[model samples]
Target: MSTLEIRDLHVAVEDKEILRGVNLTVNSGQTHAIMGPNGSGKSTLAYAIAGHPKYTVTGGRVLLDGVDLLELSVDERARAGLFLAMQYPVEVPGVSVSNFLRSAVTAVRGEAPKLREFAKDLKNGMDALSIDPAFAQRNLNEGFSGGEKKRHEILQMELLNPKIAVLDETDSGLDVDALRVVSEGINRFRATGDTGVLLITHYTRILRYVKPDFVHVFAGGRIVEAGGPELADKLEAEGYEQYTKASA
Candidate 1:
């Protein structure tokens, strides 16, 4: 069975319909890229799946490994092996990165990890992201640069090791080097387990580093096209204009 499935999903924010109806399935050990122009509801899908209170599910269901995710609370969903890395991660002042990640790790594992082991793992994750070990001591995402915030998100993904992770605009503000680092971190997370990935982005830069197993084009709040890797290449060459016009 697919690790994550969105069946006829519908969502809205403040009664303004965003995701009209969407469907996608992600199996283990595969990466699926959702590409589209701005305002195509790509971010809305991610937020709705993650149970953002602002984005209400108006219809359909989201399943994780055949379990109805809609029945679970936000934290329950995370504990059930679902993770969403936001396009704009919030900054938590007064919360050290180490403390925040440790808490998350504890919550996901249902027990506190040994301090030594947790520290070691944190250091390793930071190293993988090319982040300095000192970063763990700073406030979570507070005062962090755009690239740093993205890297921090990947770090949490590595430490949590969720079954399916939805990365929203993960490469939005990254430089070449930082993009490579973030991509490597994602690859490493998948390597640890047969993690399924749903990557949402408007650009194709990160796709070059992390090859996608499937590509879905989003337009007008729905998936207009689904294909193999070549779909991404086609989008890069011809742009989303053709798809947008066709969908319109």
Candidate 2:
């Protein structure tokens, strides 16, 4: 089984401290949900884990199954079994989705996938996410709708099958039906029992479809409360007022 442990994570952006001594752990077959108000460092934790150059890790240790992830570059971290589904997927104007996915797979696997097998896997992943087959030929996220972009992110997750997935507000900008489709795609990934999911979001709606094993409330750059599934329900009804006040 794989494990992702964040020990006393401290992050800064533009010389301003954001994450102040945060810690969490996720094991394979488990899903952890982070809910918090805006500017509470939820997305910062995601970007920090994925090695985004914009978010500087002032202090912390991010480990994947006991391996120090801080020592690796972004691409190296991906090869080491870490994946991030960005909230805003960038537009790759010249690269086809099929080509981008294949290249990414090759990089992570350290070898090219056979053409036939790769085509089959791509088709299956797209079909599972309710994405049209023709999307493979289009430039990555170029002119794609918000729902389409989110679906594509999950498609990558399905194909990559990384040890840990840090999804930043994946449910954002998705309509009701699109949200269901995306949530189902995530559920499928969770069923593998091989990928640990760190789902960061502000609302509890997605939590209904993608149940979390643990729920953490983030405020003032750190987790102020931790609980189980019930915590989500509480957040839905009571909101983050209490947590925000506590953090203040």
Candidate 3:
């Protein structure tokens, strides 16, 4: 179990400020939801935590279990047990999903999984998510449908089992059926009760499947409001309009 702490974070992309003095924390076994309209910097925070070069941290510190995260490179951060499930996962043309995951597991764990044992874990993860094993042989996220892409993200989350998982708009393009599958995968990630989750989304539908311990409303690059589960209900009923007006 690990703790992800963001304190007074200020992030900018290409000299344009995105996140302004944002502060949030996700402790082990907890889930925090960041909800905001488009362009509110939710994804910016995600990228910054993953140490994406494009989003520069103009101020503040990101601590993974009290260790400085901003100092490490992207790969080093992943190796330190921080995983970001991108809203749009990249398509690697020549790499199969299995091979990609295998390399990732090896990189993060610092050792390769035994061939037979690794195969068993892969099969179990896919079966748990109802993904066909054949999909493993296909290129990473190439030619995959929207649901498949999201499922592939979940597959990575399962295989990696990072101490903290940051999922950015994972439910964006999924239908109801796909939503169920993706939601189930999220629930599975919580089975260990030690993997923290920072789920960023615009809609409350996904929250119906996975309850959040804290709900935060982001507007204009800062967290404006935060509350318990009912905060999601209020947002659903009254909409971000109220929060937007208030924040304005």
Worst 10 residues of 3 by lDDT: 239-248
Q: In candidate 2, where is summed lDDT lowest over 10 consecutive residues?
A: 121-130
Candidate 1 residue spans exceeding 4 A from truth = none
Candidate 3 per-residue C-alpha lDDT over 1-248 given as tens digits, one digit per residue, 9 for 90 to 100? 67899999999988998899999989989999999988888999999999988998999999999989999999999989999998998899999989999999999889999989999999998887778899999999989888889988998898888999999999999999999999999998987898999999999999999899999999989999999999999999988997677766
lDDT of 1 by residue, 1-248 (tens): 24798999999899998898899989889999999999999999998999989998999999898899999999999999999998999998899998899899999999999999998998888888888888889988988899999999999999998999999999998999999999999888777658899999999999999999999999989999999999999999999998778777
TM-score of each: 0.97, 0.99, 0.98
Local distance difference test, candidate 2: 0.95
Task: At residue 122, give the lDDT of candidate 3.
Answer: 95
Is 2 or 3 the stronger prediction by TM-score?
2
Q: Tell me the lDDT of model 1 at 77.
A: 97
lDDT of 2 by residue, 93-209 (tens): 999998899999999999999999999999989888899999999999999999999999999998999999999999998899999999999999999988899999999999989
Residue 41 of model 3 has an lDDT of 87
Best by TM-score: 2
**Pairs that collide, model 1:** none
TM-score of 2: 0.99
**Model 1, residue 165: what's the lDDT?**
94
